[model samples]
Target: MNVPADDITGAPAELSVAEVRTAFQAWLHAKASELGEFRNLSTDVDEIFKSLSRLQRLLYSEGWIRLGWPEEVGGLGGPLVLRAVISEELAAAGYPPPFSFGTQEVLGPAVARFATPELAAEVLPRLLRGDETWCQGFSEPGAGSDLAALRLRAVDDGDTWRLSGEKIWTSWAQYADRCVILARTGSLESAHKGITAMLLDMDTPGIEVRPLRSMNGDDEFCSLYFEDVVVPKSRTLGEAGEGWAVAMFVLSCERGAAAWQRQAWMRWRLGSLAADASDLPPHTAGEALELIHILRLMSRRTVRSLSAGEQVGAVSSFDKLMMSTAEKFLFDTVLSAIPETLLLTDNESARDWRSDYFYSRASSIYGGAAEIQRNIIAERVLGMPKD
Candidate 1:
């Protein structure tokens, strides 16, 4: 229902989450015609990025995007829950998420907390307004799940740091304006302790980005090579030997807020799945709904914790686990109910289904693999034995 309130001016400083949602919903309703063309999904990545950037700029100008961020970083100052609502409401309205959502959720908060004031003030606003995009550079050739084993090295160079290493599985690096990188500054023996996180501009010399294609056949991820890349000391997110903490924080958001957004998109996809798959069995649909509902509930709690400024920590593993299983289950249902359309048809919709199906298979692998999440749950959350 609409709030019956005046147009939202993006300065609802004291509004509660429900109030914010009401006003935002009303605004969306009022601006329906203006945002109509943005309602559809784009097949091209460049198109998607460009369209999302435009959307971000619109939201920023309308003040809607600034509701939950600090004024120092181009926001109007409100609870972070307001930010989460913006994502949920957009997805509920059939808009694919802004490409900035993942990076903003995963990396923005870390920089806000850890970067120097000057850096945060300069970079966060660009990120929020979609003026720039950022990527997380955590995993290396040998480090994915076990991030402590990462070997990307950063050497101190007085005013700057000289970085030399490779980072793989970096999402959207080709389009990123900057990267939140974790590199080792001490001996390998120090492992996680010797690492530090840096906020580096993507255009820096000696940095190469090579996009890689997965089974979905999209180059959504890339390999980043750093050859003596010079990074200002001011770009450091946290002190030396503190990247593990920074990494943990980013992962928390990845599994928490990103999962929250994923569930929203998945809910929309579930509805679309039902509409497309008339032959989909009732039990299968019921099962899928229930799984998605569980993810929504788990993610909601994590979001609340985050909005309240609580560190969600390892509890995010539960959400990640649920998210992966639920994704695979949903797409598996698509494949089963529409095998010919999903596998043999040549239309755009068919190709989309095929791509989604393959991408869903990797859901358990990214954001901490299924096996590793189980270990975290068993030993960390459940307090069970390590083995």
Candidate 2:
């Protein structure tokens, strides 16, 4: 956790963004050498979670994961872009970022913004230190695209609220210690205005988490059922009926800053494939490089705007759209240019490629569908009239 004296002196005194980036890159390179070789142990979802948790704990102990967070959350105060630099450096050094990085970027912002100060202080550090895992309980079987139509109900009972409904596509719920859940608190006629957000313990009574096996042969996503699950009123994020705003904030972070991390990984994967392939097609490398470039540029702008405290709003849909396009395009290029590596090779590297290729299909569907993003862009960004 000892930052170089030179870095401390330069920072905030005479340092520029470029200087910070350079120092951080050097620090990451040194850490990478110390961390040594990484092995892909198992493709099993549980094993992957365990491995990622261990990796997160290591990074947390090293202070890399706490760079951009507030000091109140056990972080060393720095621009949010410092965290992005960490992820980029890790990927550039051929290491997968710890899974908690995604949760921190996606959900941590919501908790910091909406949760009580005491709650943020108590729980944020646990998250930063890898003491717990969290999941988003926003999507339902019937409410993936139109989240306002979600039917999960939460009724206030003086001091607590009883929740009843199921959440589909809840990622890593089986391994999560906490969940940021959105439930209906008003009449159905209220739509988005009826919803409320809460942070719930996964171990609470009347809750069931059932893992769903994906095409990649992993159970990363799950179905969560609640039978009158009770949550304390103190767990509410923002005011009642304002869950839509909280949800929008989380989704903006997901599509904006999180997309930067995804683009970094895509760049690393492209480089790995280029190094491993012997007979790639004439245009395959060009196509893959172009896709990564486009994604990186789009994601960078989105990240910068978010870091500047601007209300990125629906403009982030562009980032989400580019991410889906780049991801699917890159993976498709890989599958076509190196079909043997994806389908026939038996080595661990090839297995990893195949698994990644399979998961890339969901890239367009998970956060929001590609079509949904385009629609948002057309209506909101382009000012197109709705049909």
**TM-score per model over all chains:** 0.96, 0.94
lDDT of 2 by residue, 301-387 (tens): 877887777888887898898888888888898898788879999988888889899999999998889899999999988999999
- The number of clashing residue pairs in model 1 is 0
Clashing pairs in 2: none
Model 1, span 350-371: residue lDDT tens: 8878998998999999978999
Candidate 1 segments whose C-alpha is farther than 4 A from its true place: 1-7
| lDDT per model vs. reference | 0.89, 0.84
Best by TM-score: 1
Query: For model 2, what is the C-alpha lDDT against the true structure?
Result: 0.84
Error of 2 at 251 (Å): 0.7
Report the Cα lDDT for candidate 1: 0.89
> Which 10-residue window of candidate 1 scores lowest in summed lDDT?
1-10
